[model samples]
Target chain A: MFSVMPDSAVRIRDLRKTFGSVEAVAGVDLDIGDGEFFSMLGPSGSGKTTVLRMIAGFERPTSGTIELGGRDVTSLAPFDRDVNTVFQDYALFPHLDVLRNVEYGLKVRGVPRAERRERARAALRSVRLDGLDGRRPAELSGGQRQRVALARALVNEPKVLLLDEPLGALDLKLREEMQVELKSIQRRAGITFVFVTHDQEEALTLSDRVAVLDRGRIEQVGTPAEVYERPATAFVAGFVGTSNRIGAVRVRPEKIHVGIEPDAGSGGESGGPAEDGPGRDGRAEGGAGTGDRHAFGTVAEVVYAGPATRFVIDLESGDRVVALQQNLRTSSMDVTRHRGARVRIGWHAEHEFSVPETGAGTAPAS
Target chain B: MTAVAGRPAPGLRRRAAALLHRRPLLRLSLLLSAPLAWLVVAYLGALGAIFLTAFWTTDTFTGEIVREFTAVNFQTLWDEPVYRTIALRSLGVAVAVTAIDMAIGLPMAFYMAKVARPRHRPMLVSAILAPLWAAYLVKAYAWRVMLAEGGPVDQALEPFGLSGPGYGLTATVLVLSYLWLPYMILPVYAGLERLPGALLDASGDLGARPLRTFRTVVLPLVYPSLVAGSIFTFSLSLGDYITVKIVGGRSQLIGNVVYDNVGAANNLPFAAAVATVPVVVMLGYLAAARRTGALREL
Candidate 1:
């Protein structure tokens, strides 16, 4: 479908970076398709920003060949590479007005003045920052500066635009609004955007494909739903959202069904909190749930968030597991009203996925 | 509580604090009075007396202060080619020193702040500032010894078949740039240190090469500090007559004119007029530097 254009906008092969004895990005291989809105989601030290910087040619990888549109640009300087970055702080020049800042890249590349101005203005207009060409970055609000940073990069029409937590500095409401606006801008521009963010929800909301990095290695790469619904590793399950560890098995807290309370010793299968009747929830199933699984726990605490009530459960013989129940009705009989109540948490066999107790066994997908 | 035996007197301290709290103006005056007194009395007062004397003249032969209000000194200043030459030569030395110091200090400061490892940065700064510890005259004499016809400078340049420019405007500029380099380096270092690393990366990511980034991003941001540092170099170089005396073999800067007229020639009025040149030059420089946001940095 991408005629003449390389299938992958950016191809990272065995990319690795190390600082002294510490490896920041460990042998990551990813092929981000052209026009794809991809996100690298990880914690602060997970090497997500480092990877983005390497792709932008800001950080040199210790060993890797990065290909942009089928041409290797691993050794090229940032200016030689056809990509730009929207820095977290926006990094707009304080001395220059918005127009000069936005036109800086084109000006450096020797684009004609009229053409540079016209393109910079159009880019600013696209970001909804029209009529702000004369204000210095210090004069603009945080949101306006952010849009100017975006406009500055977008004006370059680079092969890939790298963003390192571009919305991280905004307030919650502004962040959400900018998230939608950024995604829409990505769609309109049709240029590949490789965004780095620690916010999983933001990643899920904005990315077409998401890659989870942990301890400088990619744990999983898939569609947002795939990574969120079916986490490939224990870290993914824990980091992406909330997950309940029912013994060795990991299941989504939202997928588990909670019963009012369980009897101390009911040994049957007919929904009597039993152990044998379709209660193949036997401990022999390890973590990957077999058929259906049932566990008994006491609801030690109930947290009432607006839409959902999270019940922190103390399983009979394992670590605490949490179950989420949506408050469909506005009645006051919340699960909180039944704190210290014994509850039965069960999930379908398919809802349960096995993960390594530790992160030693996974292999990169290449 | 019982009456304290070992405690220091609190009544006086408490009463003073209470008085200050009741009248903040008293606290403000207490904080400002000493510096203000020194500045007005020791600095501006002397400047006012000197400028006033520039309007008076002395007897030509009697060697007595006539103290007559006259424009003779200023007229002589306006009509003399010697004064013009000295003024222009001094101005040239100041400008050259500032330019050379900036040329050397910028890259050195950039290296110290950005390129050097953090562990080594303090050592670099100390080395840059270490020369200031030696007395100025001692260092200038040392340079005098080094710049002699067959001295260390000649020895160093002998292998290259080149010789140092000894004891002239060039020598004065070289010594002044050497002395004022740390002044320029420290401020520019501080300015570069305050620059966000992300800005450099952002500029490069925006398709600016290293030189381009330095020009557009680094230069503009650090320009104020450059101006601030130049103030020290320019003003100090302009007013210096000692280095010119030791290493300036035959050179006559404005400072030399002031010293000769005031002391050797016994023409205080003419000396005051000559000294006024540097003061006016500096005021003009400061006014110009203000537009570049240099005052805020200073």
Candidate 2:
């Protein structure tokens, strides 16, 4: 499966890095398509930044090779590699004006003075730092410094751009704005961008694909929608969003029959997978029926959020099912009306995704 | 309280409290005034006395200071080739010593400030400062023994058949350099240490080579320290009398000339005038150093 043809803008093969006794990045393989906004998401010590650093050539991998544009850059130094990094701290030269900072790479590449200035100005303008070219980094605000950092890297026109939590220091509103700005820039440049961030929402919002990392290893990799809707593991489910779990093999939303209530449902031995029945007592169990979900629960909590109403239902089989109902003009999932009321939770049997337990200990598979 | 409403107290206790509060300003002024007066009396007054003495003439008959003002002492300094040679030689030596000290001190300071591991750094800095903690007179006397004809340095050089003037100049530069090295290193090291580490990394990422980075980024950032250290080294070497006497091998510095005029020649007025030159030079260097960031640490 790993020996496929090189349709990727960047191919990472068996990449490994170690600092002292601590293995920062263990063996990993990945392929990022051209013009794709891919993000590596992880916690602080999860090796996301290490992988980004290796790609940027700030850190050399102890083993393996990095191929960009189908060219090997394993032993290449940072400047020699046709990739630029936007550091988290920005690392803008305090002594130089914004224009000079952006022009640094071009000058080193021996670009003509006038051409370099023109390119730098264009990059600055793209990042909305056109008129602030003469200002020093210390003179700029946090958001402005971030733009300058982005401009500095973009001015180089590298094959791949690596951003290490470039907007981590910004306020929430500013971060969202920059997320759109960065995505637009990536689209305009049509270049591969490997961004590193720990913010799950940011990764989901900006990334075409995201690789979740844990303990110097890739936990899972998928498109944002695929990972969010069909999380392969409990970690992905909990990390991407919130979830609730009860117990036993029960039924999913679409399979379970939703009746008003007959003596608060059956109170004895719970429902099991019948010979030709839809499912069983636990939502994530049973191979009884294809495209069939079943579960009965009391609507314990209903939260009417802005766009969707979230319902937390306690199943009769000692399980909880979380359901999100999109709020249309006349939707029935109102929390003030449904709270404490008994309701069966089910959806299209096809929409039910069962992720097998893998001893991950991830918030009861939610 | 009802009977005495709106009336202020004038009892003994209240009067005492009011007097005590009022006298704090007066007490503080009195306390600070003594040191201010002492500085004016001891430092400014002494300088003024020296300036006055510089214009007095020494009587040839009895070696007594003649009360009358005269330019005869200045004439002697101008007319004598020995005095002119000694003055030039002092400048030459001070400049050479300062240059060599700076060259070694700046890099050493850089290593201490930026490169040394935290666990080992304090010991190294203390070692540099250890020399200053010792008695300066004792260290100068120690060099006297070391630089003598049959001393350790000469004995060590006997095998190479090199021992006379080489010994004197080499010993002087070495001893002077060693004594003043800390003065130069600490300020420069502090400046380098206070520099932002992100700047170095940014410069490196921007494709500046190590040498280019040091020249453009590191050097300019530590200008204050360099200026401060150079002034300190030059001024300290200029005013030193014992170190030059020990290692100079009878070669005269301005300090030596002033000493000779006061002690051997009994020409106090001439010595006072010669001493005034260094004070002027030191004041000028200090002013310039302060304008830069050099004097900030001190």
* Most lDDT-accurate candidate: 1
The RMSD (Cα, Å) of candidate 2 is 8.4
TM-score, cand. 1 = 0.91
Per-prediction count of colliding residue pairs?
1, 17
How well is each residue in A200-264 modelled by candidate 2, as lDDT tens digits?
Answer: 88999999988887667776788887777677666666666654453523222323333221221
A1-97 in candidate 1: lDDT tens per residue? 2223457999889999999999999899888989999999999999999999998888899998899989999999888899989999998888899
Q: What does the lDDT read for residue B15 in candidate 2?
A: 73
The C-alpha stretches of model 2 lying farther than 4 A from their native spots are: A1-9, A68-71, A246-366, B1-84, B137-165, B266-268, B296-298
Interface RMSD for each of the candidates:
0.8, 2.2
User: How close is each model in CA RMSD to the real structure?
Assistant: 5.2, 8.4
**Model 2 per-residue lDDT tens digits across residues B1-298:** 2335667667676676678688998767767898989889998999999889989988889877898988777788889998888777777777888999889998898888878876788888898999898998898878788777788877888899977443455567678887888989988888888887666656666666677778878887888788888887898888777787787766778898889888999989999888877787788888877887667766
CAPRI band of model 2? acceptable
Cα miss at A119, model 2 (Å)? 2.8
